[model samples]
Target: MAVKIKLMRLGKIREPFYRIVVADARTRRNGKAIETIGKYNPMQEPSLVEVDSERAQYWLGVGAQPTEPVQRLLELTGDWQRFKGLPAPEDALKQAEPKPDKKALFEAALAAASSEPVVEATTPKKKGGKKADKAEKSDKAEKPEAAEKAEGGEA
Candidate 1:
């Protein structure tokens, strides 16, 4: 059987992840593999590609032909260059920055909302303003006296 180095599909639909494998060339794309050597995740911020250099070199030495995409991945990890006795490739990808946690973000917003000072509501002054207010206050103050006088006189 002709040995081949290739990628096997994994992960959820529309979100593909792959495993580098050594298998028979005649096997289906995702069929059984003789050995798994690495992983690839293209969905991440800085697409992730990983491979075992020693195993990859061994496979290459033993006449395992890598598929085109797998060759590119091996190149990204510098395994392909190393296998060919070439110098290390320059940085092809940057590391992704760590993202803040959702819970931490929510807590920060809650703390900000609570730290702000509370505002009290006040009634707006009417058209008559001070005169209307004074009249209303005087009316309130006289009602009890007027009711008391009426009650006393009736008794």
Candidate 2:
């Protein structure tokens, strides 16, 4: 039978926590798991993640596949690197404590959302003009060129 290393969602809506578990692939997400491997609380600042390294490694070695998010959590906790025959828990702990680049991530998301090209204001450029003048210039510029052409034809 196929086994999975995945997260089981818990806690209230908007405030989510999870259990890292080893379970049969057919089991429902929050159903009975074969083993509880750890806990994850994304609600907390810095987000708490605790895992049983030995059990996690054992499960992986025996062919349990982790879901994408679970795999990321494992990487953050250094479980995958350790399981892949790297350093021990102490070294992993040392490496795991680095601060996440939240500001850089936020800026990257903002940049992605604003990726479309933006047009410059078509209004006459104002030099040392008050807000009201700027508004008037914008209103004047917004008049369609077709309106100007019609006015000229009437003349």
In order, what is each prediction's RMSD in angstroms? 7.4, 15.7
lDDT of each: 0.92, 0.86
Shift in Å, residue 97, candidate 2: 11
> Per-residue lDDT tens digits of candidate 1, residues 1-155?
79999999999999999999999999999999999999899998788888888999999999999999999988888888888889988977567888899999999999998999886658764569888899999999999999999999999
Candidate 2 deviates by what RMSD? 15.7
Task: Please write out the lDDT profile of model 2 over residues 9-114, one tens digit for every residue.
Answer: 9999799999999999999999899999999998776688899988998999999999999988888788887778766444333324667699999999899879
Best by TM-score: 1
Q: Candidate 2: where are CA atoms >4 Å away?
A: 86-155
Best by lDDT: 1
Candidate 2, residue 83: the lDDT equals 74
lDDT of 1 at 72: 90
